[model samples]
Target: MIVATVQGNEKGGKHITVKDGVKIFGKEQQEYINNIYDKFHINRIEIIGDFGIKKIKSKEWFCYMKHPEVDASGRTGIAFIVWDKNTEDDTIEKTIREIGFRDEDYIKFNKEYNKIKKGKSNKKKQLIFLVGLGMGLAAGLIVITLSMIKK
Candidate 1:
């Protein structure tokens, strides 16, 4: 079992240790995380990417968890130590993408992936694309307006 640590920070900025040794029984690591959060009682959790030797400061390679209900004082913060048996980095990345997380949506993906994974829902993914489209349209209009003014 490959073990990963999930740390949680409380409202007071204190660190709270939740549960460790959280195991992923099957192939789908992300899906497993989602199910754990959904079925179990957790305040908040997130998957953080680790930038090993490459030192990549992005969410493309690591997983983590956080809980808001547990705190540093042992009151409202929880940490879930997850286990993954698969060691293939490519497979993990592929799974993330298939779940609707774009290469750029790593962080946001971590935040919302659980919702879809647990409930088997896709509402959040649709909203993300819709928001992206709206932003693109606004930018296009601004560019066109500026060009007309210059003319």
Candidate 2:
């Protein structure tokens, strides 16, 4: 029997390229990474959900990280954080400590989260959606009217 690969694990062969190492792409975030890889020759990419970041490690090159968002409450909040790791920089654990992802620590995730939900953001989107929907409905009605007239 064949075994199913587990996600986010080394044994899991779920990746775009897996020749020497690994590369995973999500959304339009690949270009920036490609440039870095071409220059640095990155080795692996691992997503630390607990830390809310994609950690890219390279033995020959510099390591870099990209965080999607910090989980603040019942849902995942939005705060795109990018860390350009350097030898002189503090350790990842220490850098994470500067962040407030955990409840016990500073968890500065809330600051960006609060800034996000200022207005009724979905209102404009919903209005545009409804307008498109109404236009579609009117088009259908006109088509039906024309068919009836033709008959």
Candidate 3:
């Protein structure tokens, strides 16, 4: 089974269980996964991509897992959160709930979500267009210079 290491309280972790006998991570590997998990479990590590990771003794290194992928729907509300530095998979998927990232719809949802999150409505998005414009201008200038040189 492909199971990722995660803190005890963490929610979204990459895990896949097998039917009979399938060990993606063996004893030593599982131990390693557990070690990191234990650290995070005791709150000894930092988040996935959070800043100030250097300051902490154990910066939460996620081979996947690390973050808390929890479905608190049974308790009442469907709350799923995955945190990182400036990145997080936070979308209250109440109506349609699916397990694992292997799902096609989940992938599509994430793609759309990211697109919406990084849409042109935000200031950060303008950088992409600006960079494209700069590249075009530079290329045009280079072509003009080349043509003049040819003459």
Candidate 4:
């Protein structure tokens, strides 16, 4: 199996890289990845497949890590996608650290992503409500002005 490490982004962006001739959700691969995530308490696992030249597809059975710290931060997390190989007898967390990712950093990344998503949702709702309110007030003012002119 190939071993690779991904770096976390500051803006809570999800980064995905596709490799050819690799299956991510075979029985053994899923079990192995699940075990590692369980041991280290990862926040989310997204499996994507390349759809010929820049398109990709999300696979079923994606695992979401329920880390409250990550859930609150709105920061992005780091994920390493291994293909065509199995993990050897080594601690997965240690390997991740060696790739310049601290355990705490991963948690923080997850938190940031969650926070950003929440903030975006909230902003959309607020903007729509404000726009509607503004339109209503404007219409009401126009009606009152017309009545005063008639009087």
lDDT tens digits, residue span 25-54, model 4: 346544655544553334333444310011
Best by lDDT: 4
> Runs in model 4 with CA error above 4 Å?
1-103
Compared with the true structure, the alpha-carbon lDDT of candidate 2 equals 0.36
Taking the tens digit of each residue's C-alpha lDDT, what string does model 1 give over 1-151?
2233233343545222212222333345455456445523342333343221110122222343332344456753233333243334444444434333346644553445444344433666788889999999999999999999999
Residue 117, candidate 1: Cα error in Å is: 4.9
lDDT of all predictions? 0.41, 0.36, 0.38, 0.42
TM-score of each: 0.24, 0.25, 0.26, 0.36
Root-mean-square deviation (CA) per prediction: 15.2, 16.7, 11.3, 15.6
Model 2 regions lying over 4 Å from their true place:
1-119
- Residue-level lDDT of model 2, residues 1-151, one tens digit each, is 0000112212332222211112335642355335544543343444344323233343222222232232333233222233333422223334333332244322343333223323334666788999999999999999999999999
Model 3 gets an lDDT of: 0.38
Between candidates 1 and 3, which one is better according to TM-score? 3
